[model samples]
Target: MLYCKDCQLLCEQECPQCGSRSLRKPQANDPVLLGVFEPAIAFGVESILKDNHIPYEKFGNLGAAVTLYVGTAMETYRFFVPYGEYRKSVSLVEELTGPAEPSQEHE
Candidate 1:
């Protein structure tokens, strides 16, 4: 598999999205966004990644501070994985939390 470093896309032949031939094998340190999930689901995602032997990084959003005073219901966490393992990690996470929906941006 080849990865378009600029577009952060995984492809077999070439990056169809960016039409860039400057692709290379994915590396263990390349970070990719897996998804942003609720606290409950984030814990599950961490466990699944560990079981699958995938390295991951987790970060809390601004709402996380509120959780310290309020509760976890309002908190969200972002998950990232090595770009090399992103595809597999995504599949595993989807099984636990269903597929992620695309976000809409207002401009």
Candidate 2:
């Protein structure tokens, strides 16, 4: 099984379809599938993934959600893995990036 060190998400030991353990990790060596977000965040994500040898790609410059929604934007980026590696990717991102701060309620 491939493990995402950043997020601690584990990919299945074997691929259901091919039964291969060739799970792809998002790293600088591989092409990352990026989503939209702020430049700082994007750079941070990339750096983390790169540092951990994860493959990824950056997309969008407008914003995070907009890139995911309209499929076009700037200032946002994301890293994508194969379907088999989805869970691991998410976990890694979460671990490396950490969870977002909770919103404070205003009285």
Instruction: Locate the minimum summed-lDDT window of 10 residues in model 1.
Output: 98-107
- Candidate 1 deviant stretches above 4 angstroms: 1-28, 63-65, 102-107
How far off is residue 56 in model 2, in Å? 1.7
Q: Which stretches of candidate 2 lie over 4 Å from their true place?
A: 1-35, 62-74, 100-107
Tens-place lDDT digits, model 2, residues 1-107: 35343333334564433455656554433322323345566666777667766555554545556657776434344445443444455566567567534431111
lDDT of 2: 0.48
lDDT of 2 at 19: 51
Cα-based TM-score, every candidate: 0.65, 0.39
Highest-lDDT candidate? 1
Per-residue lDDT of model 1, residues 6-51, tens digit only: 7565567777667888889888778766777777888999999999
* Candidate 1 clashes between residue pairs 3 or more apart in a chain or in different chains: none
